[model samples]
Target: MRGRDEESGEFFSPSRSQNRRDALEVLALGEKLVALTEAQLAKLPIPDSLLPHIRDCRRITAHIAHKRQLAYLAKQMRREDDDVLDAIRDALDEDGEAARREVAAMHRVEAWRERLLADGDAALAQLLDEYPTADRQHLRALVRGAVDERNKNKPPRQFRELYRELRELIVGGSAGTDEEDADNVED
Candidate 1:
């Protein structure tokens, strides 16, 4: 319905359009929250009051129930501070990136393990050169045990150990200390 006409002014329901936009935005947030895993949700900075709404949405499996829960969540979300939503989105994005990096690191470690197993001494020498502090004798024993286990078609106990050691040596060892050393150098 037109409200009033003032000197060629057109009447429109701007509030209705704004309400629809707000509802859509809130529903989008509800969708994102619903897609998040429990662990991810824990990381988000959501307030205690909103947790039940979010959890209820997650628990509702029926399509209609889920839709109703989502509507409730959207209404609740509209009452929250904008920063809370921003924080939740940021945390989820950060967690996603962290998970991706972890997967990539695992794949890289696996590739290195395979290379070390296939190339034997050549790869060992490369590993030693790269990680001077690595225990050569221990590594050789693990590698030998891993090879024996493979040849015998036994459970990959030693193979798993070898991967663990390589991961500890290459990934865990390098992730720390070096950054601190760099910071020290600047002092």
Candidate 2:
């Protein structure tokens, strides 16, 4: 179907090389889909129709059979709408990446909370050095309450609250630094 336009002398479709490149990109996307576990695939926006093909691709362990299945998957993917393919790519790229980062940040916060509980004043001093804007008095109060709760075998309400406050301080501090680093890079 690729030919020159009668009136404008422009191509009616992509050139052969461009067509091949597009196919390869789709093939690569198919590979990504094949490599993903079922749980990861569930997070994607891929259509149900493509799922069986992907599963087949995953199930084939033999070299030639796997290769043939991969090609079939690419062919099926190419038949899908351009918008659907693009949506799948976008979803793959942004697959709870922000949420994952936040979770990692929360883990760091948890570590700091544990350190504060274990190391007491030394950890608080180190934390203050990192987050100069942190409310020292408020943090000390929360730490004391958390310690008292642990001693009395009471509910860890203050322990949870301390974690929340630590997250706000540490994650917010890191975010500001990240923006500053980006600004510096722009210069």
Give the Å shift of residue 85 in candidate 2: 1.0
**Per-residue lDDT value at 67 in model 2:** 92
lDDT at 138 for candidate 1?
92
TM-score of each: 0.55, 0.55
The local lDDT score (0 to 100) that residue 18 gets in candidate 2 is: 96
* Per-residue lDDT of model 2, residues 55-170, tens digit only: 99999999999999999999999999999998788777755555566666766778788878988998899778877899999999999999999999999999999998987887
* Clash tally for model 2: 0
Query: How high is the lDDT of residue 109 in model 1?
Result: 65
Number of the top-ranking candidate, with lDDT as the measure = 2
Candidate 1: tens digits of C-alpha lDDT, residues 1-187: 6475687676655667877997798799789988888887787788989888888998999999899989999989988888887766666674665456566566666776777778788878877876899999998888888888999999999899998998787668777544442332233
lDDT of each: 0.78, 0.86
Positional deviation of residue 187's Cα in model 2 after best superposition, in angstroms = 24
